[model samples]
Target: MSRPVVGYAPGAYDMFHIGHLRVLERARSECDLLIAGVATDAVVLSAKAKHPVIPFEQRLEIVSSIRYVDQAIADPHVDKYLTWQRIGFHVLFKGDDWRGTERAHEMESKLESVGVGIVYFPYTGDVSTTLLRTRLSVSE
Candidate 1:
């Protein structure tokens, strides 16, 4: 039997919420297997230069527990192309919030060369971890 299409999504996945669920739900629908890259705290800090409310280990555990995700892996580096190549994934999925931007457009071009496609799902604008954090701060 042929292996089912696998979709990979990489993120810090901290303080999981509706946005995270939406991405995973859409990814699962596009492919039989959905693999997630739970960015380590070190990686998140390197990019954002701030500590995540939830630590890497906790975030990894949270994402792994989600039923939609078939597998969760640590992503210490932010190299999207390399991760997709290493995992041999046929598609890389991300939120459309980054769509049409120079960086994402460039990435799309690069991935197309190697026969892998970049799929962008609609981004949930109103609800996000950032918004949740802000609300919590106000409540406190």
Candidate 2:
């Protein structure tokens, strides 16, 4: 029997929106099981240089409750290979915006070498937490 495909979709998931749901839905459709990794506040701060609008625990809770996510876990590492080592996922799901970046290339190389594949979903160009934040700030 073939092994079940375990997919991992990691994100900060702050200020949850339809775009996040669509990615999770698509990721779930392609895999037998979808594991969503919610980046902790510290991880977000370190990577993005700004604190998440929502707290880590709250963000985790929000992602965990998504119907498309079979499992939700805290993602504390900036390097996806480290997360792969810990989670042992068969595939990684990400937004296509990362498709051509250096970090994406590096991650693809490392994960592919270990027999893990990456699936880039079409990014929801109309919405994002950054855009929301910017709009809110401008209105205030």
TM-score of 2: 0.98
**Reference-based lDDT, each prediction:** 0.86, 0.95
> What C-alpha lDDT, on a 0 to 100 scale, does residue 72 get in candidate 2?
99
In candidate 1, what are the lDDT values of residues 4-96, reduced to their tens digit?
Answer: 898888888878998999899889999988999998888888866867999888899999999999999998776677777778788989999
**Global CA lDDT of candidate 2, please?**
0.95
lDDT of 2 by residue, 71-120 (tens): 99999998899999998999999999899999899999999999998999
Root-mean-square deviation of each candidate, in angstroms? Answer: 1.6, 0.7
* lDDT score, candidate 2, position 109: 94
Candidate 2: where are CA atoms >4 Å away? none
lDDT minimum window of 10 residues, candidate 2: 40-49
TM-score of each: 0.90, 0.98
- Candidate 1 TM-score over all chains jointly: 0.90
lDDT of 1 at 7: 85
